[model samples]
Target: MAERTILVAGTYDTKSEELGYIVEVIRAQGGDVVSMDVSVLGDPPGRVDVGKHAVAAAGGSSIAEAVARGDENSAMQIMARGAAAVALDLYRSGRIHGVIVLGGTMGTDLALDLCAALPVGVPKYVVSTVAFSPLLPPDRLAPDIQMILWAGGLYGLNPVCRASLSQAAGAVLGAARAVEAPVSGRPLIGMTSFGKTVLRYMVTLKPALEARGFDLAVFHATGMGGRAFDALAAQGAFAAVMDFAPQEVSNHLFGGLSAGADRMTGAGRAGVPQIVAPGCYDLVDFVGWQGVPRRLEGRPTHAHNRLLSSAMLDAGERREVARAICAKMAGVRGSVAFVLPSQGCNEWDRPGAELHDAEGLAAFCDEMRAACPANVALHEIDAHINDATFCDTVLRLFDGWLADGTLTRV
Candidate 1:
């Protein structure tokens, strides 16, 4: 029943009127608002609960020096660091319940850094002119940020801008009020897959894992989802990871969407028990509407939706990806298993399917077997990846890992 607090952060020196209006909207909606000024320029025109001077000091700099230098980029960077520190303090002290930020490229950049410091489950929204631009990379964006394109939100506030701001305020506060934090007393298992064609094993595997007292968290193998999974895994957020799809990993290597620099190796580097598979390994995803690369025009592909397309990999590419996976798994200190479905990686890669490439699969398997390390066990199954038999094999191996202390049972 208590009032929720929302942090409204922006460069008050330039966007004072807009930010002030947002604050008023939040307060009118029965929410407490905290105004943070991240400007490193001239004095703020209005009242700011958290001023630029404090922000500069928190970032290990002084406002006077930043202003004197007159460098927009340098000042913005320092202010971002300071704002993040202040926001973290506010959240820890229970003074802020959610965050709403608005800006062009500069404002959005600062907001991204600030929101990244807050843990997941905190509602964070941004209204930005560049929300859908390709200029912003996935790694630069916080996984939980809900962004709305700042259409008509330019120099001054208009009806269109106000509508966007008001809606964003409502969304953040409502989320903070209504959404309960996720509860799972059992150990969490992270799994990755794309669409049904690639990960039908989830239908049976999920309940089986739950019956054994483990909660499964599945990440779609989209570029962003894979990166988020890798980030969380590296943070030691899960006890084990079933990385059943490495398509995003291949996608990244080829400059496609959802590929972080360290996608597949996070669990291994964190020493978390991991069972890796080449689910959808024969495909790299791209936007379905985007122009296909001239070199890859002849490769087999499947359109999963209006937005997503999966392109088949050639034998050379498959071999390289296999080597990459092996090299990464070799250094794992935790228990690791490399499971490959011999018949096919995904449903689309099976016989009679357009993406089915036996030669490519053979090349990948040969490279994987030759390059797999002694410590990491490699299991080659005759069934397709989604087949119940394949899932059963994975479950059995998972149980063995638990019994042998490879994966701790919570």
Candidate 2:
């Protein structure tokens, strides 16, 4: 509620003065500045350096030297540890309203370690040299993160970098002023969704989730998003998971572009009520006209757009996907339910489409029977995932789970 305190953090041992200049610019814009100097192996003399002591407090003694002795990897590990510790310290002390860092590649990753650790709505911005990675930046931000990268390590605060970074600082400070701080989820529930099919859910589920007096978090159905839900479920961040789009899991099995790390849908653990559905499992998505994989080239492929693609599953692939899905469902604790939409899972999976394969459905069901636990339940509905019936079913199951949550005894 008081004025926001911005945290400008970096390896101050070397770039102390440089970062200080940036901090001065931030202060000039009317803001409080707390400098977190994560000089893991070294602490340059600065008026307000706060890293060496913080790192030592977090369990590292002479962390900077240790980092220097080890390879850059080790240095980064120590630095990340030090930065995380410093950021947490500053955040808890109520002095850090936002965070900023400046460095080359090492600094970029190092600062990112801290920036990427925060929950949404805590203003975060980073200046990095490697801004070319095609993958989206970390999700520590509700709005997209602002990244500034230069080609070299040394500069006298060039006009472009200064303007860009100053803009970023202004953005961070403005965001802090305009927004109320975030409240972490209570009895957190994780849901997997895609921007497409599940977009309407924001209206339907957001209020219901908030009204239940529990925190509900929506995880994008990108490969990493699904994996994140599983990990969060395992972490007990939430006692229940509502998995709407099982596209990531299907991608892992069927060679889709969204195929991320394995164990895609394993949110049910030790008794978490995992109400799941193969929402987009109806087809695998690809990029480009070369959408069909070699194995499936002879099968059926549909061109959704100039660069986007979808493929119909034959009976065999569907069975394989079902087996994988069942395996994931079996990992959950207590009652695990995977609802199937018979009318259509995706646009291409409906009647009169190229993927209306009942054989595939039968195979998936049979596979679940063979692989899932006895307690796991399956409901086949005569509607698509967006249909009224499926949505209602999802909400009812979640409410039931909240009332009967047993995922974590503690």
Candidate 3:
């Protein structure tokens, strides 16, 4: 195989010894290394391939200007922006196959920006003191970025920190060499849902969509999964999207497990044709490990697992969710179809189920019908969301859209 080049980046002024050790290990493993220094106030003992001046200039600032700001936060923001721009350029130019950045909290913040600037398949790793901390929000994380805790290496490299750095170096190189970047062999269909227990339509729809000469990518509707789905959708990565389980919309609005405020807007913004539904829309998930919040104390709740629990939304909240969905759909630039399964949205909400609420369902349905914009095609199906009839309705609509040129065939 050809030699893979990995970009080693960090605040070299402070962590030069650590960064150098990583570079040395990569070279020892027969991988090429390119170093970048993102320091604002000081310089590395030796020069880097990309200097701090170039990084600052790429960010539309100067090293002198960054230093003049005096505040460390403001200065690091400039370095982060510049580093992201420079790293993206390296990837686009085929000069670097992977990147590994080392830092504490400030460095981790910059690492997030740099990783987010690259496309999804590229290898991006962060060796940080704050790796996996709650201080890092889910929305800021790139879908594929890896993080390893920089244990015992915050100030200087010791045996413990060296162990982490060595492993990170090897991992990024191996990932770059082994990664099979996403290929567009067939038209891709991006879908969202929870597990089969709650939303089982994806189980049937996956094989069905594949048989129709398309690839189906189902994203779990949890916080980070929806973030990944939305990120990919914003890049116009899908030929069409089946956004079947949009409960993340409610999660975002109610401070549940949110995928950020931009949830459910990705495909629409990219002008990709979409078919949407409200599967599991009546529940708001919270971190079960943290216990139920005070506000949700009286609501009907279901504990899915140790990690996740959900509470049923009241009738008023259901109406609010319906309006939110309609408001998001109003801005679609391409064709959109809204399917309202009248019987039930999820298995938990079916007749005699633990979360069955007829009044709340009725309120949601009424508001959806009343608020659905004129531009969106609303199909109020009599079947439940998990029913075969609902799947058939979706397939029929998909086929018609392909035939009518609303969606392109692979």
Candidate 4:
């Protein structure tokens, strides 16, 4: 019987021999090997489908043509684009168990894109000459994005390469055998939070959720952090969503602050019980007074730190925000509701605070009432979402939904 396939990737033209050697190592470690010939010049040392050709649609050039052009810059871009097609194919075919790649900056760029296409958990090792720097890719291209660094591009570094190859082979096999069971618990409940806004979700909402036998995963509502929360929510990982930061909505509606996901509210769809609170919808967050964009230079701004400011939201943007909220509310699978902190949303948005603005607040609330589906309970709680008393009442409502499957606000 044949063994499983391990994808070996690289600029096969430049590093064919090394790739072949690595392939040999992979096979010896009890795996069949497939090669993605991401080369620009020479032929791969082993059986390989030309990378440029496979990736042709992505880069609009044949591998041979890319090689003939002899432009490293163009070739690298072509290779990166092409790699996407090849990796996608490999993944769909289920022919790839693990992947190992080697490259310089161009090669690395191309391969990382391919790596990014893989699932969240996979054994992916990069034997690169540029691993010394701390410049890991931003998107976490591969779950296991390790590298073998050296001055000699994947070629001259034989000893280190051999060690990494052996280790990588074992690592891949071990990963397949020892797949980590997902954290055991309820569907993931996304908890949105900022340092200042954590009390509502953590102190108030989280315990309440657990009391109802729910397992919660909290997400700090930093720039991209909210998306991370939403991602988990969308995956059906969370049975419920406790969104306590409506302030992130400010960032989503207007270029205001480090808010939630770009499409922050999309996760409130079918498959989860969500209690949405616009906890921070009242203000726009910016980087300090100076970091405020020129167009926003004169807006009411509260300096929160050397690099942070909360600019008050405008009635115009708030109108759009109300629409956004209504759309999300209308799509809720279970009962979906929005809570309004009557006194304030964020710490700075309270009366006499820097973000105080009655006009903008009314516009948002009124719009919400007008646009939101009648099924969505709209509450203008007399107290803030984080106040202990407010939390108790909110949880009482949330618990009823969790237990009886009832929808609507008290």
TM-scores of the models, in the given order?
0.93, 0.77, 0.98, 0.68
Give the backbone clash total of model 3: 0
What's the C-alpha lDDT at position 383 in model 4?
74
CA lDDT of each prediction against the hidden true structure:
0.84, 0.66, 0.93, 0.65
Q: How many steric clashes between backbone atoms does each model show?
A: 1, 8, 0, 11
List runs of model 2 lying over 4 Å from the truth.
Answer: 40-42, 56-61, 64-70, 132-146, 150-154, 181-190, 195-219, 223-240, 253-272, 287-299, 302-308, 312-316, 331-335, 395-410
The order of the candidates by lDDT, greatest first, is: 3, 1, 2, 4
Q: What is the lDDT of residue 379 in candidate 2?
A: 76
- Model 2 C-alpha lDDT per residue in residues 197-283, reported as the tens digit of each score: 333554577677767766778886655566556656655566577777777766767667653544544455535577777776757
Q: Candidate 2 or 3, higher TM-score?
A: 3
TM-score-sorted candidate list, best first: 3, 1, 2, 4
Against the true structure, candidate 1 reaches a TM-score of 0.93
Winning model by lDDT: 3
Q: Give the residue spans of candidate 4 off by over 4 A.
A: 1-8, 15-35, 39-42, 47-182, 197-199, 246-249, 256-262, 265-270, 287-290, 302-309, 332-334, 405-410
Estimate, for each residue in 91-161, the C-alpha lDDT of model 3 and write its tens digit: 99999999999999999999999999998889999999999999999889988899999999988879999
Please report how far candidate 1 places residue 91 from its true position, in Å: 2.9
Candidate with the greatest TM-score versus the true structure: 3
